[model samples]
Structure formats: structure tokens, C-alpha cells
Target: MEALKEVYSRSFFEQFVKVVKREYPPFDKNRFFELIYDQAWPDRELKMRIRHVADVLTQTLPPTYEEALGILMRIAPGCRGFEYLFLADFVELNGLSYYENSIKALEMFTVCASAEFAVRPFILKDPDRMMAQMLAWSTHQNEHLRRLASEGCRPRLPWGVSLQMFKADPGPILPILDNLKQDSSEYVRKSVANNLNDISKDHPELVLDISKRWYGHHPHTDWIVRHACRSLLKQGNPDALGLFGLGNAEGIDVRQLVTSTPQLKVGEDLIFSFHIQNLSNDARKLRIEYEIGFVKKNGSLSSKRFKLSEKMYPPGTSSVSKKHSFKPITTRVYYAGQHKLSVIINGREAALVPFDLMDGNP
Candidate 1:
């Protein structure tokens, strides 16, 4: 058999042992990492390991918040997805000074790599401050910070936070979004586009506003709009539904299905449904999709889109009340509005209806 030491570098393992020993003298590094890395059941051992790490941090660091924050920053490379939760708790519980001192470090990942669970609590607790900080961050010459402001708040940030509530209201965060919509950095602009795509779910109006406002202002902004609304256009939106000259030629019937909760909390299920019919007397290969508006902290709507289904429809046939389920995310806060949801069939046209996501047990 190969040596156990062959799997990882001697120095790396030594450092790992050193850090774990310092923080959790009793921790079994091998056992802990095995559980943390196990691909089977996710999200369980992660939290537990994170707790151990935090407890270690609590013990190993000096009492002063400054010292703790410094140590935390030094240890960022060790962050796993679950350890981030521990960090969030640490910040929320005792990191006023750390929060103040480590904006750069936090922004480093908050802009691009942070877990949504860790990200949302920060914004929920203090949105205005977060907005201001993000605004200033947007202005930074560092392409990273600029990208973070757009990426972190994106409604559909892949593998990052998905703030559907902000997808609805997006008011407080709108300025920061708008600021970066036309940013100079391509890296930042891409994040801006993805962010707009996320917002398109709950607030097509705002996305449209951005598209119209920036249309032809620059080739870059034009690119952003087209990308941001790709799904909408593909879904047969009259405006965004047809950039490729495909319009709603064949007439169709439509209806709204499930509406959102009257009041949606941070962690809840958002379900919606729609009824669609192909009227033409021929078998038609059509794609059906939807955009849902989420409420935001400032009582406005932001939007995000999801694909409902795609298939060929026989004449006089209708897929009615097809239901789709989604989970409300942490970053986006819901607000009350004449929340609109849209369904698109083929590349032909779109049908619209309105609903609400409210506070409920579910």
C-alpha cells in the first residue's frame, strides 16, 4: 500500500494539523474532513465542522474583536461552504469591528464566491448600509469589487446567493445595480448582465427599463440588455421575446395558475403555474417558460425567470395550470406589489398575469 503521507504534501498536512490542533485540540482532522467532504449527504457535517472551527477561533484568538477579525482574515483560505455559516454567525454576533475592518476581505468573496445562506443575513440585517457599501465598492478601480456589487446581488448568481426578494423590489440595491450596468470592466459588465437576468424573473419592468435606458448608449450596454433578456425573448415576449424576428404569429390562449404567498419569509417555497394552449390547427413544436416577480425590501418588484417546459403541441391542445416550485432565497427580500408573471410559448408571443408572494407558514 502507498504511504498515507503520499496523498497530501507533508507541509500541507502539517499546517492542517497545526491549525486544527490550535483551534480544536480534540478534533480528528481526518474524520472531520472526511465527513465534510463526503459527497453523499451535503449540508449536514458542514455546519458541524464549521461550528468546531468557530469554537476554535473563539478560543485561539485574543478577546479583542480586532484580533479575532485579523485571525479570521488570515484563515480565509481554509473556508469551506459550511464554514462560511460559522463566519456569518461570528460576524453577526461579535464582529462589529470585524465587519468594519474586513469589508475588503468579505467583499473579496461576497462579490463572487460566497454561499447565499451566508450572504443574505448580512443584507437583511442592514440593507441600507450594505447598499452604500456596495455603491462605494462599485466605484472602486478594482474590477473585482465592481463585479462583486453586481454578482453578489444578482437574482440568479450561479452557485452564489439568489436574492429573489431583491428581484422584486430591488430599490435599495437598484442604484448599485444601475451603477454597474454600464461599467467599464468586462468582468464587471458580465456580472451586471447576469444580475439583470436574475432580476428579469420578478421585475421585467425594471429589466426593460434598464434595456431601454441603456439601449444604444454603448455596444457594451446593448450586449448586456440582450443577454439579460435572452430568456424573455426566447419565451415569446413581444419586446424581449423576439430579437431574432420570431413573433407570436399563431394565436394562443393563456391563464394564470398558482399565485405567490401573500407574505413570503426568507426560507419558503414559491410556487406558480400557468395554462397555455396552441390554437393553430397543426402540430407545433413550442417552448413554454415563465418569469416571476419577487418582492424586494423597498417594496418594489424584481424578476427572475424559469423554464416551465418545452415540447410539440397538437392543435387545440393546452397544457393548463402547469405548476413550478421554487424556494425563496436569503439575499432578496419580498415586498408587496402588483406582481406580474408572464408565460411565453414558442418564439411567437407572451401572455401575462399577476400574482403575489406574501408571509405564510410555507
Candidate 2:
């Protein structure tokens, strides 16, 4: 304990150590001190020193996500660009409080969009809170908060939420979509579109339900529906196909597309698969595309599209397959929500496979 105090020596870790030493010091003294975590209190000199620590620690990264979580929690929000590093550190840590903090601090963050962008994996670990906040965020007066609602609920978030878990439940984000279906802000509305796109992965009917109704109520809904079902509209997914009225209207038709599992852990890959067949007595040229969406720690959804698979297939094919792999570099939980794998033909909707996932921390 005394040795740690001496080593802290007016550093960021010093302040925390001073406080902890006076109260309840750690028993794992030698090894714990070895885990260098300098605080960043927003001071010019100290901030530079803090950055140095971050650099040094980067090489000796935590062996497990749990250890990284604790190191980030102690940062004082000071130092030079410590916040980002702090976030990256949390990614390494996979911290619980990091998720909550990301939510609470979303408004304060200048990079709210990016922070919102970075929080999915942490939220994936705690969907209960993530879902609750997404619903509540929808009602917030601040556009950012409202944006968080729709953005966080998305089934596929670009560079954010893991897609595997989203294929499962996608239910938590429903209310947020309902609230933001007609949002005024283009930014927020775009998030809504992406959110819907994510949901379309697993719940094409639901996406269409909200989308069709949304289109009826507001003009903005058109953009959302179009963007949400981009992959579907491009090739041909049955649900998307039927919703958009692209293929044969009054013949033997394909069933609805559904995805299960709606949560994902960092460093994990989400595997999505679905059934497909042709009732027509001809070969189908299917162009399939899949996307991964995420729920930020602050209850926003961001989407990153991935090409799951695309090809020209013969009639009567039972299924198509694709997978998305991710390493959550932040303490963000990806709420497993609806996922969409859409099939299209010459820019027309044909079929869609919808599902959810649960892949975030482990």
C-alpha cells in the first residue's frame, strides 16, 4: 500500500490511490499497482502524462475484459483526449458502469454520435437497462436523446451493435420506433431508418407494419422504408417482396422471414441463416444483402451494412447463408434485436429473412 502511494507520485493514479489508500486499499497490491492507470483530470500537463500512460498501457493490455473495465472506471474525465481512450479502454474492459455512463454522458459528449456509435457491445451485456433506456429516450425533449431512442433500438447499427443477438428478440426497441416514426430531425430520422433496416433483418412484417403505417402518416417514412429495406428492395426477400409488391401477386407465395437471438458480445461473430424457395417454375436471380445494427450505450442505434451473401440461384433452393464477425472495442452491449437478410432481383423486393441475436461480451 505504501509502495503504491510512493509510485503514484503526483500522477493521475496518485489521486485515486490517495483516496483509496485512506479508505479501503486493495489487497492485491503488487499486481494491482502494476496495472498502470493514470487519471486524466483535464489539466494540460497531467493530461499529457495521462496520454503517456494510456500509450504505455496499450502495450500491456488487460488479459480479460473485466480487468480493463476497472482501469477505465477510475479515470477522472480530465487529461488530453482521455475520454476516447477511456472509451477504448472500456471496450477492452467490457465494463458494466461504462454502459450506464455512456448513456448518462451521451448529451455531454461532443461526439455524441460517435459515443452513441461506440456503446452497443456494452448494452448487449445488459439488455434490460438498454431496452428500458431506449424506450425512455424516445420521450426525451432533446433531439439527441430522442435520436438515441431510435438509434439504439436499431437491429443493425453500422460499426456499433452486434448482429447475432438482434435476430432473437428485437422487441425492446419497438416503442422507440413507434415514438420516432415521424421525427422531424433528418439526423434522428436517419437513425430511425437505420433502426428499421436493422429490425427488417428479423422482423420484416413488423418493419412493414410500422413502415406502411408510417408512410401513411408521414412523408418521411418513405425514406426510412426505402433505406430500411434497401437490401430487400435490391434483390428479393419474400416479406420485403410482398410488402413492396414486387413479384407475382396472386400465386403460391413464400412465408414470412424471421430472425431470433438479439444480443452479441464483443470479439464474437454472429452467424445468421434463413430459408428460401421459389414457387415459380423458373430460376431466381437472388441478390442478398445483410446488415448489422447496434444499440448504443446511450440508447441510440447505428447501423453498418455487411454483404452477407448474393448470387444467382436456381429455383427451389431451401436456404441462403451469411455471417458477420465483430470485435467490440468498447464497453457497449449490443441488444439482440431484429435482423434482416433481404433477397432482391433487379432492384425489386423478393424475400427477406428476419431474426434477432445475443452476441456482445463473450
Candidate 3:
């Protein structure tokens, strides 16, 4: 597979220059290419390289923003792949002064690549005005634009600036989510769900209320509610669990819970086993999961839950065993200490076990 950095390669610049030259006859394709491929040009990272190309466009394109924007409008329709790189660059370059125009440009640019990160600065600068525009975009005929409308304003948008105001109080974004809740495109709906999920991190009750209010309205809306409540479900919040019919396991019995190793090094695996039996006479729905309480630097424990299985449990016994590797991963830092593990059935903790972690270093 080609590396992502290759997206801004010489060929990409050549294709982009070709498209620009078609609309702007005086576009100095050679000089533009030379500037982008200059010996000093840092092609080491994708984002930095994309910014370098944008800088070249600023130097080579028409001096005035409108003239350059007009040329971009023509060039944009023909641009493909990571062409949104240029559009996003344009937004970041001129968004403050040409906020309205940048919003319009992003509507076109997002269909090619996401403008979610591009629009965030404008939201942070003038949230009221920018979010008002986004609310209007929620009903846009273009699914990409509608998705951008919600995705851009996400409180915790990855790779984008955090919308802190929304994090403190997400009331302002609720209307935008409401407009797109029943959106025709799953793309738009998914963004709405993610936006809500971000809010759930800061304001759980607000998300739960929205989930309750929006439940059963439409099948698509139901999906949004479920996805929005994911974090709450992972934490085994009772309301969130009840909403998904994964409440307490009334007639369930957990037995034979054991760990393969009571102590292991960071690179080793921690295996476990368990058995569950349904005490109820009739069939019962169950959502089985496991939680691992990782020891943090402060001697406190932070738990992460993983889904094990979910199905109907007839009046019989079932056995399950699994292995979880504790290999070093970038996302988590393993500290040498005692950790806790628990079995969760229908959002109820049925068993708990402790294990010791050791650093491989001598």
C-alpha cells in the first residue's frame, strides 16, 4: 500500500496544476510545480506537505481572495482525491476575513474530502454565526455538506480543534443535531451520532435525555440514539443500558471464573475462563462483556470494557474462555501494578479477579 504522504507527491501537484491551468490560463504551472517540488520542500509528512502546496498556490494564484476563489470554484469541481487539501487550505488561509465565502466553498469541497477539520476554526472564532450557518446546512440537499454541518462542530473532533464552548454546554449544537437526526444519508446520520457522542463525554444526562426524546421516532433515529449512547453503555450506566434492553441479568449465574496467570510481564498475554448458566426457565436476552481496570500513574484505576458476546441464553450452561494480550501499544501505557478484571452480564458485574503486571526491563 502507498503511504499517505504520497498523496502530495509530484504527480498530485501535477494533476492539481493541470486543473488550475484549465480555468486560469495565466497560471504558471512550471513555477508552481517548481515551488512545490523545491529541494527545501518538506515532503516528510502529509499535512505539512499539503500546507506547503497551499502556500505555493497563495504565491502563484491571483493576488485578491475573490479572484483566487473564483479560480478555485472552477478548479474545485474537477479536483479529486485529496483535492480538498487545497480547499481546506483556502478555508484556513481566508476563513477569518472571508468566512461566508469559505463556508460556501466548503460545501463544494467536502464532497471530495472532509471539511470537518477546516470549518472548526471558523466555529471557534464566531460560534454563533458559524453555527447558525451550519444549522442551515443540516438541511442541505448535499449529504456531504449536511454531514460536514454536524461533523465540523463536534466538541471533540479528532484531528480538529476542540469546540470547547460546546464541551462546556452543548445546547447550541442540539438544534443542528436535531435537524440532521432523521437525515436521509447514513453519512449525515453517523456524524450526528458522533457529535452527540462527543457531547455525551461532557454531558451524559443531556445525551441520555436526547436519546429518550428521540427514541422510537424513526429506525434511523434509533440508530443515532444507540450510537450516541455508546460511551454511557460502555460505562454500564443504568439508563443507557435500560434504553438498549441490557439491564440487570435477573436469572443468570456466573461460575468458574479464573485467570491463566496471576502475574505476567508487559509483553505477555493474560488469559481467562468462565462459565455462565441461565437460571430462568424461558429464553432470556443477555449482553455479556468484560471490564479491565488498568492501573493509572496516580495509583487509581481506569477501566475499559470490551464486549464478549450478546445472544439469547436458554436455560442451560455455556462456557467461554479468551486470551487478551498486554503488548505495548501506542494508545495505552502499561504500568507495573495490580489490575482488576470483572465479568459483566447484562450490564451487571458478576465476577471480579486481580492480576499483577511486571515490566520486562531488568
State, as a TM-score between 0 and 1, how close model 3 is to the true structure. 0.85
TM-score per prediction, in order, is 0.52, 0.45, 0.85
Candidate lDDT scores, in order, read: 0.60, 0.54, 0.84
| Predictions: Cα RMSD each | 12.0, 15.6, 3.3
Worst 10 residues of 3 by lDDT: 40-49
Please give the distance, in angstroms, between residue 174's alpha carbon in candidate 2 and its true position after superposition. Answer: 1.1
The model with the greatest lDDT is 3
Better of 1 and 2 by lDDT: 1
Candidate 2: worst 10 consecutive residues by lDDT? Answer: 1-10
- Candidate 3: give its CA RMSD in angstroms: 3.3
Per-candidate clashes come to: 35, 102, 0
Clash list (residue pairs), candidate 3: none
Q: Which of the two candidates, 1 or 3, achieves a greater lDDT against the reference?
A: 3
lDDT of 3 by residue, 1-362 (tens): 57667767667667777778888989998888788888866634677776677778888999988788778877776775664566777767765688767777888888877788888888878888988888888888889888988999999988677888889988889998998888889888898999999999989999999999999989999999988988888787989988877768888988989998889899999999999988889787788899999999998999999998887778889898988899998689999899998999877899999999999687
lDDT (10s digit) by residue, model 1, range 256-347? 45555533443455455555666787766555767766666776677776666555667774745544443444445556455677775655
lDDT of 2 by residue, 110-215 (tens): 1322345434655676777777776887887778678866765566665444645666777767777778767787878888778777777777777767766666
Better of 2 and 3 by TM-score: 3
Deviation (Å) of 288 in candidate 3: 1.8
Ranking by lDDT: 3, 1, 2
